[model samples]
Target: MTSGVIRRVLLSVGVIGTGQWLLSDVVHVPGGGLGVAAVAGLWWLSRSPKQPRFREPASLKGWIERCELVLNQFEELEVVLELQGLRSPREKELRRIEGFDVPLSVGVVATEGSGVPATVQLQQALAGAASLDLCLANPLPVTSTSWSWPDDLQELDVLLHVLPLPLRAADLLWLDQLPADRPVWLLLRSSVDRSAEDHLEALRCQLPERWHQCLLPWSGEAIELRGVLQPVRQQLMRAERVREGTRQRLLNNLHRRWQADLETLRRERFRLLLQRSQWIVAGVVIASPVPSVDLLAVAVGNGLMVKEMATIWSCPWSSEVLQVVARQLGSAALAQGVVELSGQALLGLAKLDGASWIAAGAMQGLSAAYLTRVVGVSMADWMALNAGVAEPDLEELKRQAPLLVARAAEQERLNLAGFAQQAHEWIQERNSCTPA
Candidate 1:
């Protein structure tokens, strides 16, 4: 109910009650009706329904789709396939070429001079491939032979045939001289009566950048193919390297920016959450398990991150050489100060003392996650505090030392069992500490 309506109702009840009360109490007229009416009015005012307001939730699906679409626009995989004469062998070749695994549009341009045999094959091969405008340049006019092409592929043409004749051998000198609208791959007799290198060089000199050469023998055999696509391959390699470097650089930059932005957002989220939550201790069951410093920062920045804690704790250290190390950690050697036990001692400490110290610290809340702001912790302090652990020498355990073997075997079993038991105890302990 609105405050306005409530106020008016309360006012009416007050006036009516006052008039009645005046007649009864002041004028001595009897009846307890005025008080009852006032109570009823107030109750009615309190029982009205409130209007609801609605809001839309924040969703990023639309934005994500738009971003993906934009990224896909940069994909470059277009390649054009060029076929000159589609004959018997050419038909088979065309089928194979079209069948090749390439996600590109193939544009075939047949010469008008190609015999009817080649022309029929070309038309058939064009059945399932992309057909750019076809140009025919024959001496005599032919019947309407191109009528049966698919509607989408009926764009045929009649152009001058400027090769293999009056267009002298030297006339074909410039492959670059071809029209820019076309992507060319000359299908010539592999073993021409003349030199292959000279022929290729002549065509290479004349063709425009649009021309890409692929030599095929008259027999259409794959084994006999020449021109290993070397030039095109080289160009593609250079372009690929340049593109890869650019893409890698862009990815790195984007990742770095994302990390920076996320870090700031996380900090904000943490602050907001803290304001809305309470952190009461269930007594000092364990001194603020939260360390006064961040463990990850200390480990990484100080170069003391645990390297072999899992192995020493979980795997046998005797036949494993690591069990012996676990024994040394809680042993007198650890208490005697920085006692450096090269083999067994190091391994034992890594498993037992190192794990216990770190685990105890973690449970106490002396973890990196809580101490993100502390910057004074150093590598030495981290190592001294058991934040750093080393690998166990499995190979050495199998060596000729009897004392090592005996101790390793005992330590290995204890380390594994201790690790499991400790894990369970920590969980129970932490749960008990959290306030209900």
Candidate 2:
């Protein structure tokens, strides 16, 4: 008990130290003067919290159904982009999993020499499967080796290559074409008990080392056939798991591609929506003298933008959720002094003096717009991370504020010139619309 306790304590310490190093030193992504706590929080939030499985998994049909629904959502997102003269054909990739099979079948291929004798050996071998651990149906056909079969040869789960003594050149050519992903067992047979293994091992260097284990010596008798077929049975038993894993992988890959494409289109829509929301907030700032209701107006405008963003992601949202994201980003932006930095940036762009009121409205408009962009971008990232998860905890947004705000700031800084031009035009248009 004492040794086990000490070992566990040491393991816990090592794990903590490794996680600390990974957060503090390995991942420097949030490094634009952001605090170490922010980086640590970001790394923590990014990991999936599911425990590892040690046993065989149940059927994944339910998960596959959810993916199908997501594919339908992808089609809807595609229609949104198509309205603006852009076409995305990737949603159609979901057709790959339409008729996927969950079970695997087996096939056999035999060499030229000892044709009838090889058939007898294989027949007895498959007959012995009754005593094996796995229940396998023996599709017994004493088939001759061929390069390819007429019917769907891919249906075969395990291909057993039967070898008779005295290796032939044609046998090597036949072995070369067998599928690499599927296992091919080399069933070795001898007519007499005095036969040597060297004659059968002529192609040893050319074959994989793992295939060498499948070499079994038999004079083709019924009693010993069961053990010969055990290894082949084991490989076939894993076919269902392999097929399930493959289907899931195909669906997941398509989902990722759809996500990337969808995010690209949604980013453009986010900027457009932020432009409209910030202009409304700017008008509110100018309309109110005392500024008590200005915050409410900004909140309302941002709430609508969040709702629209949720619609874009095919998710539902609430006002409370909106407040959580907006409040966190607003405070972090101010804490990082990005609001002042943005104001100073516009003052330099307009080439106006600090005391000049000429660009004040434009500055106000752009500042509000900048914060909205950061919040919208941050919300998009959070939604993407929490998609398909029902009722994700809102507190994660609170904990993830600094990293989300910093990352969005970095992203928005890339197109500052274009945004400045849009902000200037927005202010001028609003000024013209006002009564003289």
Candidate 3:
């Protein structure tokens, strides 16, 4: 924290804390200075988004640095998966490429009949587009064999799908499936439609959300379409000036794919960890003699799960640091009666009530396990966000706790059916093995 930011934060906290102390009804929690400071700091952080950026850089060099950070995040994800004896898709090193060249490559796909002639007119209109090698939507005479988009122009920076209305279902599906990496313009050649603006209102209902603005209405000669493209040309020109423009766009495409792959792998590995951890906690609870012992046993086991989760994110948060997060989330859950609610809702959630559930201390054990998962997963999110930044102290964790816990609870509620089945099976197995 900078001296100025720290001074301002302290001043605000001091005013709030003094008011809180003077008011008898307010909470006076011991060792809650961190949570108190968290409230002010979070508000301050929200107001100022230009917080000390670490990986964010200027020009092409900045892009390269962000790419490195993404690579490292994936590398950690791979390690986490590997520890579980599960192999993840290898994340190859993203290195700097010298003298990189980028082109505003555009692809055009047109409907048959009059659409083919309209595309040729478009080619003539854009004859001076020197930077881009625009795809000829229909280079050869119209035939069933040439209906497909050109295979050679697979890597496109922009696309123009010329359609003679009424629009076809196949065309709408194609546009929907197309990735949002580049701009796509739907060149409509409808005889009945007056202007492209007329089709814009209609196309909004059928087209994907992203392509709503990229619609171009063509009524007169294809050469007149150039006027419609002025805005598109300006957008492209602006992109060209940004971080060597074309090169940055291509890099971003690759980076987005890498991050997406990492996310899939991370979720798979995290699921496996949660499954193992939750089952173990359930076993501990079932084996314990009483409700008091069950809580203690569940806590001890849950702490280990939290530790493993932190290790996966490569977080430097100590056990004490983790406990602070757990404490905040747990208090929020308890205050909202989430603990009691989850237990009571378990059978209702899964719609399962059986002899297995009626077994000795079954409700206590199952609820303990369920609550462990809610708290553990919530901690994982906190760790993941802060792991990239500086290690957040108690204040930051407490500041984020209520929101994160509430979100996690809502998400878990949606998946209660699957969890209920798992709990039912676990209890059945336990009952079968234990002496009656």
All candidates in order of TM-score, best leading: 2, 3, 1
> TM-scores of the models, in the given order?
0.18, 0.52, 0.50
Whole-model Cα lDDT per candidate? 0.30, 0.54, 0.58
Q: Estimate the overall C-alpha local distance difference test score of candidate 1.
A: 0.30
Better of 1 and 2 by TM-score: 2
> What does candidate 2's lDDT look like per residue over 253-320, in tens digits?
45555556667767777777777766554543343232232233234345446677777776544544
lDDT of 2: 0.54
Clashes of 1: 32
For model 3 the TM-score comes to 0.50
Candidate 3 lDDT over residue span 205-320, tens digit each? 87667876777777756557787666556655654553264445555555555555555665577777887667655654454443442233224334446667766655555555
Model 1: runs farther than 4 Å from truth?
1-117, 123-178, 190-198, 213-436
> For this target, which candidate reaches the highest TM-score against the unseen true structure?
2
- Give the candidate number with the greatest lDDT: 3
- Model 2 deviation from the true structure expressed as Cα RMSD, one decimal place: 15.8
